[model samples]
Target: MDYEFGMLAWSMAGHDKDKLYVIIKTEGEYVYLSDGRLKPVERPKKKKWKHIQVRKTIPEELCSLTEETIKNEEIRKVIRRFSNV
Candidate 1:
C-alpha cells in the first residue's frame, strides 16, 4: 500500500505494536509517524513499511494539512478519535 502523508498507520510489529500514528512523511522503505504526545510532529518515529499497516485514511482535519502545516494538537485529536482514547 502507498503510504501517504496524513494517513493513519497501525504498528503491526516491533515494540510499538498496536499503536496508532499519523504519517508525517514517507521515505524509500520507511515512514515517519507521530502520535502528537508520545511522538510529537517535530520528532516523529521512523518505522519500516513492512512493520506498519497503513490505513490510508486521512481524517477530515488532516486531509487539508500538509507535512508542514499539520500540528501536534490536530494529530492528537485525530488519533484520539480513531483510537477511542
Candidate 2:
C-alpha cells in the first residue's frame, strides 16, 4: 500500500499553524484547496502535455511537534519526531 504523495505546505488562513495537504494520486495534478488543476510550466508555443503532479496533504493531528504546540517553533522538532529512520 505504499504510494507517493506531494507535500504541499502553507499557512492556514487565519490560523497560526502551518497547513499540510494529502490527496489521492487519482486526483492528480491538483491543489486540494485550489479549484484549478496544478499544471507544469510550458513555453507558449508548445502544446501542454506532461505528467500530472499533485500536492498531498499531511494530517493535521500529526502537525504538533513539541510537548505542547509552541507558536513560531522551528520545524526541526516535527521532523525529528516523525521522520523515517
Q: How accurate is candidate 1 locally (lDDT)?
A: 0.92
| RMSD (Å) of each candidate, 1 decimal | 1.3, 14.0
What is the C-alpha RMSD, rounded to one decimal, of candidate 2?
14.0
Candidate 1 per-residue lDDT, tens place, 1-85, comes to 6889999999999889999999999999999999999899999999999999877668889988898899999998999899984
Pairs of residues at least 3 apart in sequence or in different chains that clash in candidate 1: none
Worst 10 residues of 1 by lDDT: 54-63
Displacement of residue 39 (Cα, Å) in model 2 is: 27
Tens digits of per-residue lDDT for model 2, 1-85: 1223223333344332333222222233322221112211111111111222223444353344321332212233333333332
lDDT at 79, model 2: 31
